[model samples]
Target: MGLRSLQGRSGLVTGAGRGIGREIALGLAAEGMNLALLGRHSATLTETLHACVRHGVKCVALAADVAHPGQVKAAVDSVRRDLGGIDLLVNNAGQVDRAEVPLWEADQAQWWQVVETNLRGPFNLLHSVLPGMVERGSGRVVNLNSGFALRPDGRYTAYATSKAALLRLSDNLAETLRPHGVTILDISPGAVATEMTANMPMFADMVHWGSIPYLVATVVDAARGRLDPLHGRFLHLGRDDLEALLRDAELIRERDARTLRLRPYGDEDPLAAYS
Candidate 1:
């Protein structure tokens, strides 16, 4: 896993219309990989596809809502037919609630919508896309995760809860994929400035924004096997040092750090092992 070429590989990227997803799509395309761009808006998807094709790689844009099971299934079918096969999947589509409010005051439908897009969207893609990967014996999945998944936030409960569950999904799925030569990982883009971020009251005082180019490069690294050491763990671009983490991979795994888990009171606690 020290080095591998992404040339000739094919991938599917959800929410490829704009922002981080579009950058990632272009990054992969530049590396000579074929791409299938998925999102709800066809016009934006077309724009991304145009940009991706300029990299001189095969590309297609398919419009569909990732949150809907049927739509995702159909889109995946098109990917299989158009791109030949999906070697890597980037689950980048997500939604946020209306405002930073308490759970009781949050709009019920909007809360659930956020959860549906962030959590169920990934579930639908995994379910529809994983079987083929398992059968082939090698694959990679990159779920665009968030820091909120690591802690609780009453102000953004829906986003926090869904991301937390998604992280758990990767934790367990990694074990299942290991024997099959597949890997799943979680990564947070680190408070990147976007329309979504500008609207959030939490980042009003922010000065620096995370680099989308760096995030795209990291995603490419994962596909090229440079980050195979971190297959199941969380990678927070803002907080983690890539070289340090890679060099200390064994120590990190030994301590089971950088993952979501319950902490016990002390080593003497009877439930310490489980925690």
Candidate 2:
């Protein structure tokens, strides 16, 4: 789709100071959407704005730690005031505990920091944005989840657990907001080369099998509303397995609904428990 289509649209991108968030912000700006960029590092956010200004879209860089509810609300409010109402919200801020710590041995501060950033950050942003979006009767919410959300490995308790919770939040929020013409999507961009993963011991190996550009393209499509089925579900970028993703989401929804539907029956009909 042509970028001009989004000329008047407004978007807020968290973590726009670097990496995947920066890329998403640039992509949206390229589509002519005015941007509200959020990050803790002022210099990095400013760099992101400069990089995106070429798209001829208005860009405002705001420094705020998204994990803090107060800061999140203040920053989002400012964005709404400065850039007009937000038509789309990209929840991309996240953190991971040091790579070497075992789950049981993880420091309390490190663990909480990861949870606050990866989980609480989005919750705070969503809490702030959804009310306005709901009142407006239309909006798009994109969550930057991780592959770990689905297939968690050991030694990643903080990151994995928070991401898993985020997926649940996304699924519930999608259903809750869909009636208002709001869509919530959780995007797992596979592996990417970013500051988050740069210092990792397995960085090179992860990148060898990761698909960065594919993930970015998928986000672009999502912003343009071209990605179907995956709109209310999780996406594994660069794989192009939309059919599989859709199928899995459907299966999950069906399973959940079935469980709920059967719960009442279980108490009334002993035979129902067998099924």
Candidate 3:
């Protein structure tokens, strides 16, 4: 499925210099979505821009850390100035340095840092981009999440908790934006071969079930409204229930009940009961 229908759309992807973010940017470019790519590494960021151009989509590479409020504002403003208002925003920037650290030994400082990046980072981007999107009355927001958000496997406190909050954040944003035609989705990809996972201790433990492109496709699908069933819901990407899950309109509608309440992010335990 070529996403040529997405040709005229424009988007901003965080952490897009390498790994999954890089693949996502390229995938969007292939569909003709112009990109405003953001990352910390200047060299890798430039490489993403070139890759987007190779796919023949307009591209702008912005070097900025997603965790920095000032940098996030500046980068988003620059994207608006350069590529027009973004029609899509991919909150792909995340960190899990302490995933293996025991909760008792977790550094509070490090935990806060990861929380700021994994959760607050997306919140900031969505906050900055949302008003314009709401005023425009249409847009898409894809918040990258992890399966651990729902099924934590110990030693993943910071990562899992942040992502859990992120999933709820996506739901909250979606409900508020829905009446205005802005769709928000939480999509969790299975293990992929990325720098973040490359040499991690648990890397070999999990199945290399898929690739970065699978996650990218979910973003593209959400952008095109093909993923409406998963909007405002936590969608696990690598399940035997993939097809049924995607097609389960009733399941989606049930989720809408929870999404409509406009609950605060991080209160997912209440919603989980409904699930």
Candidate 4:
């Protein structure tokens, strides 16, 4: 498929109040896409809203906790009413573990909060908006995933587990929604400099950081349908060569690469079966 223009399209970006989400919202706005920014922080959402408005695109800031179904429903209704339905949905809102602690030692409330915010938050938003997207027969979804999802990190079990589940959710949704012209992708912005990372002591010694522009460009490409061929696959900003991936889309599909799957003990293992 040819690259599609995003001009005049409508999108909803969760956690658009600050950090990577803010950058993504502004980037989409620069492409002339109308936006509905959803976040818990009113002040930061207002800041992002102004930044998006400066790009001359229709934008609205809605203060809502994505984990709450009622709030998500209200926000989705507002976006549909104001922007004429959503063509893009970015599930960027997430929560990290409050501290580096073992699963057994971590505060139960904090642990569950991370899980609910990162996982259920996306579920809430999707539940509210997916019906409209499916009805329209055209839509895009980008779920911000993490490297932790692929690797086991004992210190942040909740975050790792939630992101891992989210990646699987994207893969499953992609298969279900593909025939409807809706593409779902998982994007991992590895080690980007953000308030969330800065607060994590584990990353204090990290010298190399992912480029925000590169991540934003990846999101923009996904939003414009340039990545439809690789839909349901995982893409890493500042690491993966997107052009090469696009060129080898068929091979990746054939190999079933970049997706989560259960590995069998041996080639003859019956438990290793996959479709």
Q: Write the per-residue lDDT of candidate 2 for residues 54-173, one digit (tens) a residue.
A: 889899999999889999999988988888888888999999878766787889998999999999999999999999989999888889988788765676889889998898888667
For all candidates in order, the CA lDDT equals 0.90, 0.80, 0.81, 0.91
Question: Which tens-of-lDDT digit does each residue in 205-245 have in candidate 4?
Answer: 99999998888888898888999999899988757989999
**Per-prediction TM-score, please?**
0.96, 0.87, 0.88, 0.96
Candidate 2 TM-score, true structure as reference: 0.87
- Candidate 4, residue 126: how far the Cα is off, in Å: 1.0
Instruction: Please say which candidate is ahead in lDDT: 1 or 3.
Output: 1
> Tens-digit lDDT track for model 1 on 1-275?
11225778999999999888988998888888889999999998999999888777889999999999999999999889988778999999998878999999999999999999999999999999999999999889999999999988999999999999999999989878889988898999899987788899999999999999999889998888788787789999998899999999888778887788889999998888887
Q: Sort every candidate by lDDT, greatest first.
A: 4, 1, 3, 2
Which tens-of-lDDT digit does each residue in 1-275 have in candidate 3? Answer: 25576888899999998888888888888888889998889899998898789877889999888888888999899999988988999999988855587777888889888899999999889888998899998888888888778766668788888988887777656667778888787777877777787666887777655656778877777877787656577676766355777777676676464232434456566664454
lDDT, candidate 3, equals: 0.81
List where candidate 1 sits over 4 angstroms from the true fold. 1-5
The lDDT of model 4 is 0.91
| Each candidate structure's count of clashing pairs | 0, 0, 0, 0
Error of 3 at 212 (Å): 2.4
RMSD of 4: 2.5
Worst 10 residues of 1 by lDDT: 1-10
